[model samples]
Target: MTHSQKHIIGLVFYPGMTSLDIVGPQQVFSALPGVQIHRIWKTLDPIKTDDGMIVLPDTTFENCPSLDVVCIGGGLKQQAIVDDPEVLEFFQKQGKTAKFITSVCGGSEFLAKAGLLEGYRAATHWAMRQQLMSHLGVEVGTERVVVDRNRITGGGVTAGIDFGLTIASILYGEDTAKIIQLLLEYNPAPPFDAGSPEKAGSELVNKAMLFIQEMSDLELASSVA
Candidate 1:
């Protein structure tokens, strides 16, 4: 990266995406120097997240500038995004030259669908990890963030923070990443130690699995309707 060139990042936004998946990384990237962030979509319209929060896109797929990093955040409507030809083509185009191709959660599915993850190892939400390995032939990872060469991926939702910091450290050095971490007060002390399936136990994990399946079914039905 030349000092004259700005570090540009394109964060894909689409309906039904998880807000934190993009926002967390955005917050971390925003604190860095000489970086430009673009919220990109097929259109410049307002996008509604899975949780009903509305976000506006600043750039469209056709008009987005070349990016240093191309990232997508995932959620329940992943199939829809993956099935969209335009989205897949856009990702394919960006992946050709983007220094880093990345995603959080099920967003990696989009890259997989675009044929960008063909030879890379990746990390995604636990819910989608099996499918990526089985269906897409990706070397799915179990870590919070997985970096295979230029493909930097994050685990489900909250791992975006760790993912961002990891990318930051790689781009700007550990000292700079530490400075940004301190500025953001990036400390984690959750009230419960139930962040993972193993810790949450079978009961909670089963319930969560059931709920996620039900939601997926409903969303699939709704999309068709």
Candidate 2:
């Protein structure tokens, strides 16, 4: 699928952005020919991820060309994305003309914060599902991947690959995406089958509660509200 004008897909990164949130889905999108991927930021300075991955922006917020899709990666810095009204405004702008707009984990929450999910069914990692619904009034679901109109979403980090494939299929065709999947050998298996809440038992669920203690009280309160 070659368009004379490159279809640009932009991602916003900041301190603590999830590495997998950007890379996992990125591989899938980059696999497509003629689709350009860009690291977009408020500035052109070097950026870092939550897990110590250093990245350079391909473009800045003011200089970026029209986006075919704009996805915001999510992690601990999701609060920052939520706080930046300018970033949300950019999403709303690109989203209006973008052929498809989507997110992976808490990225869905960013989309909601941008006021782009109004009256649209969206999905995010189950952990942020409550916050997305509470702050943005958008319903969240537990699907591993979701496609409600032009908006696409997936569960946490692990679901990004699936999310990307679904987006590719929507853009090109099932044939194109399936071939790419086969080339990439996307068939996945896990040592443990406890990836999602449905697959995990109470013990795993309980252990996860311990990690929640690390999050700020504000996020927890908003999430629980």
Candidate 3:
């Protein structure tokens, strides 16, 4: 594809977003051919993630081009952006024409809040599923990756990789996506089998929830500090 013909993909950036949620998908998309990726935010200023990693925005909400794909990564700070009219309006506008509107982890909450996923079935971090249903009345999916029409969503943080590969297959082809997978050596051999609540059991799930709550508390404190 020519420079002008490259697919424009915008990844929304915000304070306290889970880095893996963005990075996993970004890595997959970055290796694809004829694609331009933009780290978009309300401004070009640097923002700190939930883990204190500083990320710089390459484009702003007002300056971003019409995107073929628009995605967001979820974090504790995602709740803050849900109510921001600027962000919601931006999504509302871009979403009208974007070929794919997607999110990872808690990012679906942002889209739901923007009134973009009202009739769509989406996936999000399992922990946040109830909140989405209760607060936003979103139809939640139990899969690691959910695709309803042009709206795609990934479960939790690490699921972003699977989500990206799914998009790649749709955009390019299964063969091309397989090639990218091989090039990235995207083989999984996780030592533990506790990736999901069903396998992790009640005790481990409870512990994980506590840890997540602690992280949320820290994020809240940092946001106000």
Best by lDDT: 1
lDDT of 2 at 128: 80
Return the clash pairs for model 2, or none: none
TM-score, cand. 3 vs. native: 0.94
Instruction: Give lDDT: candidate 1, residue 10.
Output: 93
Model 3 scores what on Cα lDDT?
0.90
Q: Which lDDT tens digits does candidate 3 get at residues 149-212?
A: 9999999999999999999888877887788889889999999999988889999999999998
Q: Estimate each model's TM-score.
A: 0.95, 0.89, 0.94
RMSD of 1: 2.0
lDDT string, candidate 2, 97-207, tens digits = 887788888888878877778878877887788788886799887887888888887789978888888877877779878988998899998898988776797888767
CA RMSD per model (angstroms)? 2.0, 4.0, 1.9
lDDT tens per residue, model 1, 1-225: 223446899999999999999999999999888899999999998999999999999999999998999999898876677789999999999999999999998899999999999899999998888899999899999899999999999999999999999988888878878888898898999999999776899999889999999999999888889
Q: Which regions in candidate 1 have their CA more than 4 angstroms from the true location?
A: 1-5
Model 2 spans > 4 angstroms off: 1-6, 215-225
